[model samples]
Target chain A: MTADRPLRAGAGLKPEHHRHILESRPDIGWFEVHAENYMGAGGPPHFFLERARALYPISLHGVGLSIGSAGGMTPGHLARLKKVADRYDPFVVSEHLAWSTHEGVFLNDLLPLPYTEATLALVSRHVEEAQTVLGRPILIENPSTYLRFEGEEMAETDFLRALARRSGCGLLLDLNNVVVSAVNRSFDPLTYLDTFPVEHVGEVHLAGHAVLGDIEAPLLVDTHDRPVSPEVWGLYHRLITRLGPLPTLVEWDSNVPAWPILEAEVARADSVLRAAGEGRARAA
Target chain B: MLPLDATQQTFAHALLRPELQVPVAVAEMVGPTRERRFAVHRNNVKASLVATLAAKFPVIQRLVGEDFFEATALVFVERHPPRSPVLAEYGAAFPSFLGTFEPAVDLPYLVDVARLEWARHEAFHAADAASSSIGSLAALADDDLESVRLTLHPAATVVASAWPIVSIWTTNTLDAEVRRIGPDTPGEIALITRPDEEVFVHLLPQDADRLIAALADGAPLGEAAASVPDGFDLSTGLALLFSAGAVSGLLEGMSE
Candidate 1:
């Protein structure tokens, strides 16, 4: 179960806990950080992150590239992303399946895109361009969406599968997003996961999400402020069974607690990976 | 079956416009009354992005307070959603946006505050460089100081503003003494640098104008001092600069 498939279990590092994380250097496999947070050169963030980089495999997760927009990718954005990737040398890089910009102004949100032939071509090229600049493949994560485009020609799974197949990039399967999007969109979460092309998955993200209480609404929000929901955790366990111990992250970005609270979350993952070795997840 | 191009547009439109009752086939599995679930995704996208902007421009949020800031933030979001997924680089043009905003017109100084914040943000992430030693700088004779080109750290930022933005920003900032907060006077220049994680800002009217002019022309230490006269204490400034490691090196003055 642990055959060195690039596994890491970590929480998103916050400014409040930077010193604590670095000082403790807990037994976690790796730590994930937002690429934008490290865009600056001389600061405590950089200082600590660099020091920690010596010990942990860092992952750069981007939240702003509007890859889905028909308007095309920004050269400046790609150049900046490349520079940070070069500077940090993060072991893995990932971004949402959603789009965030249009005509230069950024909404700073992961907005949905119509999954069409044109979009497929646009997003695929963006991914290809990113890879070309980086000289390596990045993991394009499936997004948690609130609304569906009325005219989508391809299924979300098909679009992602096609993107991975064509661009040669890996997938960062966010199970909570899968569950959130599935429940919100009224698709079977298992069917979605089962139909998902798990072969290309390089990492998995397990984060908390709050369900918008509108039965009339078809959206499940990705809040990332609380503990991973039990249902989402169950999905994560299933993911490990299939993907076989992929790098898993537990992200708690808002109202983040002390290091000990986050460490407990990491501990759960450690046991999950440990159990996987014994072929216990299938039984559980 | 929806056309690939048509479906995408409609779907994106439906996703954004929650009021739309159109039951596109892709969401059919969501069954009737499925719009609520879809709203979750919309809420997430909105909430997260808003929070990002808030984090980046806390000073602006503070000036306007939470409610007004959030309302304006929403408008800003719809108009200028981030082009890149990188939140750090998301609000590059926010200062300009704040300038043209009608609601913010009464607070003319708001835009400049954004500019200063952006400058601090920019300086914080700017490339690091080694500072030149004071010993070598001391060797430069009186004649050489005026015409030589002085290398400044990439993180050096000089911002000139009409409002007491420095004080206003100071008062509003988490680091600033809250009771000292007051209005800004015009034509003030603020210097910002991040030799460390904590960004430092200094308000120097005469020194700022002279230094900014001199720095722009790539003036050496002596020349920069000449431009500022008694206004700039070159020795003191140089000491600060050397300690802060603001200089990469000093260039020999060809003009002298």
Candidate 2:
């Protein structure tokens, strides 16, 4: 795990709440920002990001690195990521495990990847390339996948563990994504979490997902628009209780509510971490 | 199973083309729910990119009603999905697309208005540099002034249009009332700059774009000023530039 991981609970920063967060100086553990938002040469995004960086530890997360792309990664994106990472020196830097670009077209979503030996090697090399350019190791988040691919290869966890071991990168275990993927794929969330490479997990993401279609076999979409779901919260608590509280972030990107709402989510995660820490201390 | 690259290529190809069948690879894996699951990715890609366009070109979206804008935008997205992930740089070709688009032919000014908005977007995110005050120009002698070269601020841009785009942009972006503009309205030159925190769009007198373009092309003040038409308000143009902090630094002529 990276030494710069923020162990407490944090909130994803939204543009709407930039002024409010800076003014109020909320007592949150840290702030996570999407790297794509700040890639512009200079503007309000940079201005507010600099101010926010001064007040809180920031985790730079990239949604567009396209690490799993077989056509290779997007050109110049790594340099852009490097610029943001260099500017912010974020406590932790991360990107998704899925590809969003193919044949020179950026799809703008975290599309899934097949877990094959070829993909594992490609992703590992891409992660190494990113770490080499940024001069620091980065964490790879498990994407909230909607569908699986037909392939004869390893399980998702095995692939991720191998990628981490090969590339020396850490894992950003998004619990909401775990629940979302589990429900959509008709798998047990607990079993998946039980097998996750928790030792390599440096951070955890808890976000709200939208359940659409049939009530019995709903398709869980990783919407990140509302408060964290109870199922996700339960998984988060279970993970923290066992993993001893990695850095947790509550993400609400769309239809964002007031700062207090997001702050409350962070507070809830913080309390969970505190309880887990207390339990550990009692055990000691 | 498809090769890794072929799998991504097939998946990506089908994502943009909804009419195509979900790849047999994905279909076979997810079973009956495959189409709905595949639609999730399709919806996400188009919706997010459309949302990005909407955010970048709000005035374009407003000028045409939301439905028209989105309908046209979907066509644009399919034909020209972003080549890069930095969405701020996505719609560089949109203004030109609007110009040739048959649906927008009635509103001839739509293309230029889109250009003006794109210019404002560019200026808003261009590299930040300190603007040199007009006080420096005052130091130059009358004869030396024409030879002096001024550096434009990095965030400054000149958007020349054949319609009253500045007013259109201003009215749409701000809380101002909708001022009626006619077909015969004279063209305006928009000077966009973000000297400090806010992006300012100032409508300069006609033909100011020529001088600004010349100056931006590394021409000295005299060379650029000479290229403009007679009766052109050099003072108004220079004043707008300096007031907006568009002038960054001055380089004395090499003739000296």
Q: What interface RMSD does each of the candidate structures achieve?
A: 4.3, 1.8
Candidate 1, residue B231: Cα displacement in angstroms equals 5.8
CAPRI classification of candidate 2: medium
Please provide, for model 1 over B92-136, each residue's C-alpha lDDT reduced to its tens digit, 9 standing for 90 to 100. Answer: 778889888898899988888888888887877777766577787
lDDT of 1 at B99: 86
> For residues A202-248, what per-residue lDDT tens digits would candidate 1 score against the true structure?
88898888755556643467878888899888988887866566788
DockQ of each: 0.38, 0.65
Query: Could you say which candidate leads in lDDT?
Result: 2
Candidate 2 segments exceeding 4 Å error: B29-32
Best by DockQ: 2
